[model samples]
Target: MPAASTGRRIRIRMSARAIDEPHRVASQLELLFDLTFVVAIAAVTAQFAHDSAEGHGLAGLVPFLQVFFAIWWAWMNFTWFASAYDTDDVVYRLLTMVQMGGVLVLAAGVPAAADHSDYRAVTFGYLIMRIGLVAQWLRAGADDAASRRTALRYAAGITFVQAGWVLRLVVSETGALPPSAQVPFFAALYVLELAVPRWAERTRPTNWHPHHIAERYGLFTIILLGESVLATSRGVEGVLGAAGAGSPLVVIAVSGLVLLFALWWLYFLAPAGDGLSDRRHRSYLWGYGHYGIFAALAALGAGLEVAVEQTGHDIDASPLAICYAVAIPVGVFLMLVWMVNASLLAKPVMRPAVILGCVTVILLLPLAAPQLGVAAVVAAIAASCVLLVILTIAPWTRRLQDGCPKP
Candidate 1:
């Protein structure tokens, strides 16, 4: 019915979706749009793995964060805008496809950005995406009187920031900036990018459906997790081809699979949909916090790949550094999840003791690598994750010996 109706609805002018509309959900076009990100994420993960395998993991950290911010922010900006004003018309679809093309452009530039610190291609790709988005905002402003001011505000802010992004390259090329100022320049633009939506929504928040937004974020999480599974497979295969099936890589492979599964299970347990429905005003914190969550998950995929490489002696990185690669991202992910839930959930999603304990144990597990070896430590990390799942399970079934958990 929606497929048929979208064609009919094409004739109607764009307008804000009703906040109380029943059965609001992601459209087919949205799913297709999300599929493009798989390539973007896979490119970023592969580049990170390359950097780590070459023993540049520490130095690669800054570029990794910078490149990932581009990917996450692009996807999120489109998501919220669509939640409020998706028309699914001919022009709308074409503009979205244009943004999808920009994602590919950005994905193609990840290597140059990471390896050489050259961001020309990345900046150009981001410019393409923002141009398409600006057009969308313009259309929304012209067609929907209720949201016109906010839409125009979004359009102007995005345009101005994109100009800054383009100019950042020219300024860097002239060698006018001190070496220490590079990151701060980037960070200033980041603050402006984050501030755009906040400034726009102060007058009247767009009519985004809470459930729809939650579903979109959940889908993106699955995409990242799926990418990790693929990265782990590639690493395990490399080890297998070289060392045969008898290698400890088999143990690492199995443990990684379990770790991915357990993390996936834990992510969906947050009840984000209900909470967002109840506390709409806290949306920015809950929404923006996922940047850390998504970035950590993407980096974890790269880390898992490096862990396999280190285990197989294919990489020159220290064993402890390799282990920390996996452990650090895992810890960050755990902490972010807990913090996001604490901010949004009506009831505490999990006992903090369980989360903090698992994080402490997970981080320290790598210290045992000297005695237990990398495979054993990886398995221990996976086991600790499973333990977290077990403790948090059936929380409603009964109170624990620890007494009632914090709200």
Candidate 2:
């Protein structure tokens, strides 16, 4: 009887530990929640494409950046929460459902949220989502003392930042503040938002599953890539339909497809998860750096959609459009390379590759403006991609050789 009791205790302990694992098979409900983000991505991309095509592209950037940050921030908050305290109990799962509903409402408000008359509805929805996050953190703090303190810190920091957001929205709606002042105010709040995690980690470092965080990030990357492909397909189909079904536009579209695939390959070749698993100290750099990367990827897709719209049209595509399309992807690709090098290899050689790629794309911009056109611009992007692919593989080769026994 004693042996049986001991076995039961062991099973219970193991089960409890498994619940705390970050990558613990996310519940089916969590997966369903993630699906809503697909709509969010599509909505953001659509707004970007529409604004760019209508010559209001610059106007769209602020809203796009704001929306992107909000969505990314929400995801990051939940990822860390799940990493530490994914109970997978009925209560936990139900709270996740509530958050998922909040995301949908937030997404639905995107179109008008940018220029809402009051900004109250959008702010309220966003606040609700954030409140859900705070609740999770509070729960963690209550369940475990170490985690509880950490959770309390997170809740405090995040709640403080959300209050700032609400105030900014109110000021924006009221027009009591100058436009220039608004950005600086929000910028200061952003700095605080970023600093909070570092502060919390210092005081009471939360136990996060490195592998789980890595996998969750990987899934997000795949979602961004899938959006790119979807944009490419829609762009190509529309261009082909308009251009007599056998135009060079199809070629441009195919080239864009290949370029996206190559960029995706470049991202995954570095073995980021393996490197990060053992070096939890680098999590801050890795996590924050991805924000820019994700924005760039989404913007790249939007730019590509614009390129497709201009294909075979009499309206001469501006150098800026072509440059924007090429530059965004190159920038994203380089950022990924830099992050990996910084996090894993502790080298800066990737900087030169990025500089070279940027210079190449910029030099090609004028040439593409009114003469070389979309196809040529895309070819230049592909060339830059090829250069990056070569750079990505070279270090791995050297590492492998170094690992081998002396001859």
The lDDT for every candidate, in the order shown, is 0.88, 0.69
Q: Give the Cα-based TM-score of candidate 2 against the true structure.
A: 0.85
Candidate 2's displacement at residue 110, Å, is 1.7
lDDT of 2: 0.69
**TM-score of each predicted structure versus truth:** 0.95, 0.85
Q: What TM-score does model 1 achieve against the real structure? A: 0.95
Every model: Cα RMSD to truth: 2.5, 4.9
Instruction: Estimate the lDDT of model 1.
Output: 0.88
1-407 per-residue lDDT for model 2 (tens digits): 12234322322111113323433444455567678777777778777776777666777777788787777777787877777666565566667777777777777877885554334655676787888888777777676764566778988998999999888887887887787886688678778878989977777667666666766777787788788778767777776677754455665677677777777776766556556666778888888888887887788788777777777444344756655655665565566656654676545445565556654664455455567666667766766676667765677678778995211
Worst 10 residues of 2 by lDDT: 7-16
Query: Which candidate's TM-score is highest?
Result: 1
Q: Which candidate wins on lDDT?
A: 1
Q: Which ranges in model 1 have alpha carbons more than 4 Å from their true place?
A: 7-11, 399-407
lDDT of 1 by residue, 13-120 (tens): 779988777888899899999998999899999888888888888889899999899999999999999999888878888899999999999999999999888898
